[model samples]
Target: MDEVSPEETPSQKVPPWLFRAILTGAVALGGLYVLGWLIAELKMLIVIVLVSFFLSFALEPAVNRMERLGIRRGVGTGIMFLALLAAVGLFLWAIGTVLADQIGDFADDAPGYINDIEDWLEDTFDIEVDAQGLLDEFQEGGAVANLATRLADNLINLGATVLQVLFQILTIALFTFYLVAEGPKLRRNICSLLPAERQRQVLSIWNLAIDKTGGYIYSRLILAVISFLAHWLVFWLVGAPFPVPMAMWVGLISQFVPVIGTYIAGALPVIIGLLDQPSTGLAMLIAIVVYQQVENYLLQPKVTAHTMEIHVTVAFGSVIVGSLLLGAVGAVLALPAAATIQAFLASYLERHEVVQELEDAEAAQHPEREPLGDRLRQMLDRVFTPK
Candidate 1:
C-alpha cells in the first residue's frame, strides 16, 4: 500500500469550560479597569459626599435636641445652617473691621514708623541709612508696579476660584441638610435592605460614627476656646495689634485645620509683631512654641482620651496617613474616622486576659515605671485637682 498518509492531524481544541473561563476573566479585567477610571473621575464628588456625611453626623446631636424641644427636623436643620452662616458673617465683619482699622492707622503713622526704624538701625548696627530713600526706590523700581499688574492679571482667576468655593460650600450644605433632616428615614431604608442582625450592626455603626464625630467637634471647640484665651492674654500683654482677631485666628485655625494649620495660624501674629517691635515678635513666637508643646504633650492627650477615646499617637498617625491619601479633608477627618474604627474593632475582636508571665516580663523591662493606667490617673488628678 502507498505510504498511508497519516490522517491530517486535527488541531487541538480548547475545552469549552476553559474558553469560557478565559472570556470571563478578560471581561472582569475590563470591568475593573472601567470602574477604576470612573472612580478617578468622581473622586471630588466622593470627597464632597464624605465631608457632608460627617458634617451631618456632627450636627445630628444638636438637631435631635432641637427635635425634642418640638422643633421639626427641617426647621432645626435650617436654623442650624442659618446660625452657622450668621457666625461666619460676624467673624468676617469683625476681621474686616480690625484689618481696615490697622491699615488706616499704619498709613497715618508710616512716617513715624520709618523714623523709628532709622533710629533703631543707627543705634543697633551704627549704619547711617536713609530708610525713606530705600522706600522711594522700592516704589519706583517697578516691583510694586509688577505686583499690581500681576494682581490685575489674576483678578478674574481669583474671582472664579471664590465662586467655585462658594458653590462647593452650597453643595455641602444641601447634602448635609438632607442627611440631617431625613436621617431617620435614611436609617430605616438602609435597615430595610438588611436582615435583623445586620440592621442592628448598621444602626450601631451609624450611632457610633455620630458619637465619634460629635465628640471630635466638641473637643476641638473646647481646645479652640482655650487657645483663644491663652493667645489673647499673651497678645494683650505684648501689646500686639488686633489681639482679639489674631487670637481668634490662631485658635480656630490651629484647632480646626489639620497638619500645617498651626504654622499658618501663627504666621500673621508673628509678622505683625515683627512689624511693631522685634521684641514683641520674639515674645509671641516663644509663647506660641511653648503653648504648642503644652498642648501636644499635656492637653491634647487628656482631652482626646476623654472625648474621642483616642490615643494621641494613633490620632497623629491617622492624620499623616489621611493627608497622604486625601490631602486636607482626610487630615481633618482622620481623628473621628480612627476613633470609629478603633471602637468598632474593639467590640468585634475577642479579648483574653494577658498571661501572668507576659505581664511580669513587661514589668521587668520597665521596673521603675508605674502601670500606664496608674500614671494616666495620677496625671489627670494633678491637672484637675485644685491647689
Candidate 2:
C-alpha cells in the first residue's frame, strides 16, 4: 500500500462530532422507519385485541348471570367461550355447505342464465343483442380461458386467506381468554397507569365503552334474530328455493354489514330465481325490498334505541368510513365506534358552560344572539337618558 499524505489522510478528512452527528441522524431515521412499519403490520392484531375485549365485555352480563346461579367465574367464562365457539362452528358449516352447493349450481347453469339475462335485457330495453356472438368471441380469444385460469388462482388465494384468518381467530381466542380471565386486574392496572386525579375519569370512560359495546352486541343479536324470522317467513311464503339457508345468511350478513345489507342479502336469492324463472325472481326481489323497508322504518330505530341511541346518519357514515379502511371487520366495529364518539361529544357539550349558555340563548331566540346582561343594561340607560 502507498503511504498517504497528511492532508489526504482519512482520519483528517472529517470531524468526529460531525460524523457522529450524521451517523446518529441516519440511525434515528432508520429506527423511526422500522417502528412505523412495525406498527402498520401489527395493526390487524391490535384490531383483533380490541374486538376480543369488546366481545369479552358483551359476554359479561351472561357471565354475571351464570355467577348468580352459583357458577364460578372461570367455569362460567369457559362455558360462554365454548358456547360461542360451537355457535360459530355451526354457522360456518351451514354457510360453507350452502355456498358450495349454490356455487356448483350456478356454474352448471351459467350459460343458460347468461342467455336468459341477455334476452331479458334486450326485451326490456327494446334493443337487440347477441349473447352467442359475445360468448363465441370470449371463447375464441384467450380471454375466457385466461379468466377461468385466473379464477382458479383466485380461489386458491382465497383458500389461503381463509386458512390465515382461521389461524388468527384461534390466536384471538387465546388472547381473549387471558383478557377475560384477568379483566379486573387488567382494569386496575390500567387505572394505576394514570395519575390519582385522572384515575376516576379513566375508569368512567372504560365503563362507558364497555356499556356501549355490550349494548350494541346485544342489540345486533336481537336484530339478527328478528331479521332471520322475517326473511324466513317471507321466503317460505313466496316459495323461494333454499329459503332457510338464504334467510339465515341474509340475517347474519346483514347484522355485520350496514346500510346496504338488505340489498346484498337479496342478490343471491334474486340471481337463483332468475336462473329458474323471471316472475319468481321479481317476486323475491319485491319481498326483499318490502322487508327491508319494514326493518329500516320500524324495527331498526326501536331496537337500536333500546341499546345505544346512535343517530342513523352517524351509523351510516361510520360504517362507510370503517368499511373503506378495514373491510368487514371495520363494518362490524363501526356501530360501537359511532356510539362511543356520540357519547363523548354529547358529554363534552353537556359539561361546557359556554356551549350550554349558547344552546339556551339559541332556544330563547331563533337565529339571533341575545345581548349580555351588561350590554342590555347599557342599551336601556342609553334609551332612557338623552343620548
Candidate 3:
C-alpha cells in the first residue's frame, strides 16, 4: 500500500460540548449587540420619560393638596401647569424687552464707543488705533456677506430644529400631565402586581422619592427668589439699567447652573454698569461678592440642610458624573436624583453607633494640646491596629 500522507488521515471528531459552547457564545454576543443598539436608538425617549417622572414627583404634593381640597387631580394639574407657563412667559417678556432696547441703543452708540476706546488707548498707551479702518477691512473681506449667505442656506435646517424641539416639549408636557394627574392610579396599578411585602416596600420608596425630589426643587426655588431680590436691590441702588431682568438672570443662572454660573450671571450687570459709569460697576461688583459670601455661609446651609440633606461634596460629585453622562440636563437633575437615592439608602441600610475611641479621635482638639502629625498617627494606628 502507498504511504498515506498526514493530510489524508481522518481528522479527530470535534467535541459536541465545544461546538455547543461556541454556538451559545455567538448567540449571546449577538443578543447583547442588538440590545445595545436598541438602547442607543431609544436614548432620547428614555431621557424624556425620566424628565417627566421627575416633574410629576415635584408637582405631586401640590396636586395632592388640591385634591384634598375637593379639586379634581386633572384640573389641579392643569392649573399648576398654566401658572408655571405664565411665570415663564413673564420672564421671557421682561428679558426680551430689555434685550431689544439694549441692542438698538448699542447700535446707535457704536461709533461713539469706538471713538472713546481709540481716545483711551492713545491717552494711556500712546497707541494710535484705527477702529474705523479695522471695520472697513472686515467688510472689504466679504465676511459679512459670507455670514449672511450661510444663515440663508441654513434657515430651513433652523426651522426644522425648532419644530423638532417643539414636538419634544409637547411630548414632555403630555407625559408630565398624565403622570401627575393619574399618579394615584399609577401607584395602585404598580402595587397590584406585587406581593404585599413588595408592595409596601415599593410604596415607601415612591413616597420617599416624591418627598426628596419635591423638597429639592422647592428649596431651590426659594433660594432663587431670595437671590433675585437681593441682586435686584443692589442693581437698583447702583442705577443699573434693566435691573429686573438682570437680577432675574443672576438668580436663575446662579441657582440652577453649578460651578461657573455665579460668574456668568454677575458678568452682565458688571459690564453694563462699567459702560454706564465706573463707580456703579465697582459698587455692583462689591455687592455681588458680598452676597455670594452670605449665600454660601448663611443662606445655602440653612435652606439645604432642612430640604436636601445632601453633603456639598456629594452633590458636587453627582453633578460632575451626571454632566459627563448626559450633559446639561443631567446636571440639572443630579441634585434631586442624588437626594432621592441618598434618602432611600439611608432608610434601608443598617447603621451602627461609632465606638468611643473613634468618636473621641474625630472630635476637634486644640492644635496646641495635640500636634497635628501625632493626632493623625494615632488615628491611623487606631484604624489599622488589630482588635
Candidate 4:
C-alpha cells in the first residue's frame, strides 16, 4: 500500500479521554432507554407495590395504636388484616346478594317494563316501535345475546384473571405486613444513609410525605362515609330500590375515585329506575346531580384542605393523565401522586437558595401591592431571578 501523507493520517485519532467520554455517554443513553422500557413493561407490578406500600403506611397508625394497647405486633397486624378481610367480604356479599335479588326482580318484571317503555316512547314521539322484537333480539340470539354468549365462553379465561388478582393481593399483603412491622427500622436506615447536614432535610420530607399521605387517607375515609350516608338518606327518602347496596357501592367507588365517583354511583340507580319508570329515573338523576354539586363545592373542599391542598384543576388533570397512563389504578392514585409531586416542588422551592433570595427580593420590593397584575409580575420575577 502507498504511504499515507501526514495530512491524511486522521491526526492519529482523538484523545483517549474524549473517546472514553463519548463511549460513556452512549452507554448511559442506552442504559436509560433500556430502563425506560423496563419501567413501562413492569408498570402494573410497580403500581401494585406502590399501592401496597401506601396502604400499609396508612394502616400503620392503627397498628401502632394496637401495639400501644398491649397487643403483640404480629397479632395486631393479623387482627388488622382479619378486620379488613371481614369488612371486604361482608361488603361484597351484601352487594352480591342485593344485585342478585334486583336482577331477578328485573327479569320477572321486564316484559311489563318493556311494554310500558315502548308505549311511553310511542306516545311521546308518535312513532311506533317493536318492543318484543327488541326484547327477543336481546334474549338469546341477538346482539346482546351474542355478547353474553361470548362472555360465557370466556369464563375459563376468568380463572387466569382471578389467579392474577389473588397473586397481587397476596403480594400486597406480604409487603404490607413487612412494611408495618419494620417501618421504624426502615425509616432509621433511610435516614442513616444521608449525610449529617442533609439528614434533617430528608427527615422533614419523609415526615411531610407521611403526614400528607396519612391525612389524605383518613380524610378520604371520613368523606366517603359521609357521602355514602348522605346518598343513602337521599335514596331512602326518594324510595329508590336497593338504596343500601347502591349507597355502599357509591361510598367505596367514590373513595377510590374522587370527582367522578358521584356520577358513576348515580348511574346504576338511574338505569334501574329507567327500567322501572321514566319519572323515577328523572328524579334519581336530579338527586344525583344535586348531591354531587353539594359534595364537590362543600364537603370535598373542607375535607381535602387539611390534607393535600391540591388545586381542583391539578386534581382533574392528574386524574386524566394518570388514567391515560395506567387505567383505573392510576386514576385512583392520581391525587396522591399529584400531592407527592406538589410536596417535592414545595420543598425544593423553599430550600433552594436562589428561590429564597428571589422571594426575599420580591418581598422587599412589593410590601403592600396586591393588584392582580402586580402580584403576577412579582411572582414571575421571583421565579426567574438569580440568587
The C-alpha RMSD of each candidate to the native structure, in angstroms, is 5.9, 11.1, 8.3, 9.4
Q: How do the predictions measure up, each by TM-score?
A: 0.82, 0.72, 0.85, 0.79
Q: Write the per-residue lDDT of candidate 3 for residues 297-381, one digit (tens) a residue.
A: 9999999888888888998999998888778878888888999889999999999999998767766552336788999999999
Clashes of each: 0, 0, 0, 0
List the candidate numbers ranked by lDDT, top first. Answer: 1, 3, 4, 2
lDDT: worst 10-residue window of model 4: 137-146
Best by TM-score: 3
Error (Å) of candidate 1 at residue 78 is: 1.7
Cα error, candidate 3, residue 281 (Å): 2.3
Kindly report which residue stretches of model 3 are placed more than 4 angstroms away from their true locations once superposed: 1-24, 137-153, 364-387
Instruction: Give Cα distance to truth, residue 188, candidate 3, Å.
Output: 1.7
**C-alpha lDDT of residue 92 in model 4:** 94
Residue lDDT tens for model 2, 236-284:
8877777787778788777766777767878887877666567778888
Worst 10 residues of 1 by lDDT: 137-146
In model 1, which regions exceed 4 Å deviation?
Answer: 1-13, 96-141, 369-387
lDDT of 4 at 5: 86
lDDT (CA) for every model shown? 0.88, 0.79, 0.87, 0.80
Error of 3 at 302 (Å): 1.2
Q: Which residues of candidate 2, in runs, are more than 4 Å off?
A: 1-35, 114-160, 348-387
Q: Which runs of model 4 end up more than 4 angstroms from their true locations?
A: 1-15, 138-152, 351-387
